[model samples]
Target: MKMNTKGILFVYTMPLVLLHESYGFFVPGYPTKHISVSPQGKLLSTRSIPSTTTKPSLYSPSTSTSSLALKSSASSDDVQSITATNKLDSILSKLTSAFPFFVLGSAILGLMKPSSLQWTNQGTLISWMLASVMCATGLTLEKKDFTNVLAKDFAAVPAGVLCQFLIMPLTAWAIGRTFLLPLPDYGPSLFLGIALVGCSPGGTASNLVSLIAKADVALSVLLTSCSTILAAGVTPLLVKVLVGNAIHVSGWTLCEATARVILLPVLMGMIVNAKLPNLASKVSRFTPFASVVLVSLICGGVVSQNSSMFLSSKALLPLIVGSVMMLHCVGFAMGYFVPKVGLKFSEVTSRTISIETGMQNSALAVVLARSMGASPVASLPGALSATVHSCLGSILAGYWHSKNKKGKEESSESNKKDFTDRPEDDYPELLI
Candidate 1:
C-alpha cells in the first residue's frame, strides 16, 4: 500500500513540478509531501497524488517556465479575438445608422449617370414594379376599415383631406412662384412636382408613419386608400389647372394618360386585392424590395436622360434647392397646421399628416413627365423629392416612435397602480 501511494504521488507531482518550475512557479512546502503547482501557479489539493512525495535534493527555480510560456501564448489569441469583434460591431452600427442616407445618396448618384434615365426595357420593368407596389398597398385594406373611418365623424378626417388637396396645392404654387425662379426649360419641372403633390393621394408610407406616432391607424389607412383612388382623377385635373401651360399639357390628354398609368393600375390592384386576398398578401410581402427597385430604375433613368445637364455644375444649385424647398415646405406646413384647423389631432396624427403630405408618389410624377414630353430635368424635382422626403420622413417617424414608447410606458404604469389599489376581497366584484 505504501509503495503504491508513493508511486501515485510521483506520477502526479513529477510532471507538474517539471512543467511549472521552469517558469519559477513554486509550490511552497512541497518537497516534504505531495503538492503541485498548476500551470497558473495555484497550489492544487489533489487526492489522486499521495503524500511524502519525492523531490530532487537540488531543486531549480526555473521549473515552471514551460507553463508560463504556454499561458503567454494563449493570452495573445484572446486579445486578438476581442479586438476583431469590436471592429466588426463598430462597422455594423455605422452602416445601420447611415442606411437611409445611403439610399438617398445612391438615388442622387444615379441621377448623375443620365444613362440610367433612358426609357428602355428597364423602364417597363420599373412600371411593372410600381404596379406591384400599388397592389401590395391595396392588399392591407378591408371594406370595414373605410367604414370605421367614416364612422369617426371627426372633422380631422376631412380636414386632413382638405389640407392634402387644397392647402398643399396652394402651398406648392406659392413656393414655385416665389423660390424656384422661373426657367422655360426646367422651371416647369419644379412646378410639375408641386402639382404632383397637389394632386397625389397619400402614399403607403403614411400608414407606417401613423403607426409609429400612435395615431389612428385605421383612419390613416382609410384616408390613404380613398385619397389614392381620388388621386387618379384629381392629379391630372390639378396638374392641368395649375401647371398645364408650363408643360403645354392638353388637359384631356394628361387626364387620359394619368388614368391609364396611375389610376387604372391602382384600381386594378384594389380590385385584385378585394377578390384575391391571398395573392395580395404574398405579393405585398415584397413591396419594400419592389418599391426600392422601381425607384432605383426611375432615378437611374432620370440620370441617364439628363446626363448632359448633370455634368454641368452650374445647374446643380437650382436642382437641389428647388427640390428641397418644395418638399420641405409642403410637408412641414401641412404636418404642422392641418390638424389644428377646426379638429384636434394628437401630436402623432399631426406628424403623420405632415409626412403623408410631403412624400408624394414621385414615381407617378416621373411617369407623368415622360408622358408630357417634358425633359428629364422636369422629372428631377420628383426624383430628388423622393430621396429627401424618405430621409426626413424617417427621422420624423423615429421621433414619434420614441414619443409613443414613453406614452405606453406611462399608461402601463397607471394601469398597474390602479390594479394594485383594488381591494383583495373585491376582485370578483370589480370584475362584475
Candidate 2:
C-alpha cells in the first residue's frame, strides 16, 4: 500500500493530537471534549459531552440513529465550549496587553485611598508579593532558553547585566549628589533611595515592555535573571561603597534577603515549569495580570505610607523628581547607545537592553529600604521610580509597536508589487 502526504502527516501528528485531548480531560475548570479524527487522519470538530455520555458508535447499522443524535448534542456543546474558551482567552490577552495602564491606575488609586492598601506595608507581605512576581518571571522560561544563551549568545547577557549595574547606580549617584545638596536633613535619605533603585535588578515589568516592543524577550529575561541573582551580592556592596558612611548598610543581610525574596522563588518556579509544564503553562497565562496587581499593591503601599511625607517635602520634591528622572534618562540613553555603538548589537537587541537597564526593580529597593530601617522619605523615591519608568517604558513600547506594524505593512506591499511585476513564464509548471 502506498502512503500519501496526508497519511505521513497524520502518522506524525496523531500522537500529539491524542495527547492534547488526553491532557484536556485533566485540565481543571475547562470542560473536556472528544476530538474526532477522519480516516485520513484529518482533525474533525471536537464535541463536548457530559462525562456520563457514551462515545458515538463507529459506522454500525444497528445504532446509527442513536449515534447521530449523540453526536449532534455533543457538537452543540463543543461550539458553546469553544466560544467560551475564545472569550476567556481574549479577556486575558487584553489584560496582559494593558499592563502599563493597570500599573498607572493602581498608583493613582494608592494616592487617592492610601489606607486601602496600607496592609501591604508589612514586611512579610511585601516579600511574598515580590517573590510571587519573581516566580511568575521564572515560570515563563524554559531550560533550553538558558542553554541557548550560554552556548550561542553568552556576551549579550553579560553586556546587558554590566550596563544595568554600572550605568544606573552611577547615574543615580551623580544625580543625587548634584540635585540633593540643598536639603541637609532628608537629602541623605533621598540619595540612599535613589542609590537603592539604581543598584536593584531590572524590574519584571521590562519583560512586558519587551514583548510589546517586539524586542529580544529571551535576552531580556536572561539579563533579568542574571542581574537579579547577582543583586544578592552586588546591590549591597555598591550601596556600601557609595553611601556606607552616610548610612549603615548590612551587605550580608541585604544579600540574604535578596536571595530569599528573589532567587528562591524563581528557582522553585523554574523547577515547576520543568517538571509540570502543563500546569505551569496554565498558570503562566494569568501571571502577567497577577504581577501587575501585586506590583500595584506594592507601589500603592509605599505611596500610601509615605503620602504625608511626600506632601511635606514640597521644598525637595522637584529635586527628588529631577534626580530620579535623570537616573532613568541616563540609563535609557547609555543602555541603547552603548550596545549599538560599542557592542555593535542590532536595534532590537539594543532596545531590549535599554529597557531592561532603565527599568530597575524599584519594588525590591522599597522592600530593602524598609527592612533596613532607612528613612521613610527614602522609600518615596522607589514609588516614584516605579511610576516614572513604567510611563517612559510604555511610551517606548507604543512607538516601537507602531513602527513594527508600519514596517510589516510596507514589506507586505513590496512583496505584492514584486509578485505583480513578475512574468508568468517564470513560474514552474505544476506537477499534478
Q: Against the true structure, what is every candidate's RMSD? A: 23.4, 16.0
TM-score of every model versus the real structure? 0.67, 0.76
Task: State each candidate's clash count.
Answer: 21, 0
Encode model 1's per-residue lDDT on 3-52: one tens digit a residue: 34454345324433443443111111122223333455333322222213
Error of 1 at 148 (Å): 1.8
Task: Estimate the TM-score for candidate 2.
Answer: 0.76
Model 1 regions lying over 4 Å from their true place: 1-105, 112-125, 415-432
lDDT for 8 in candidate 2 is 41
Per-residue lDDT of model 2, residues 123-173, tens digit only? 589878998988887787777778876776677888999999999988887
In candidate 2, list every pair of residues with a backbone clash. none
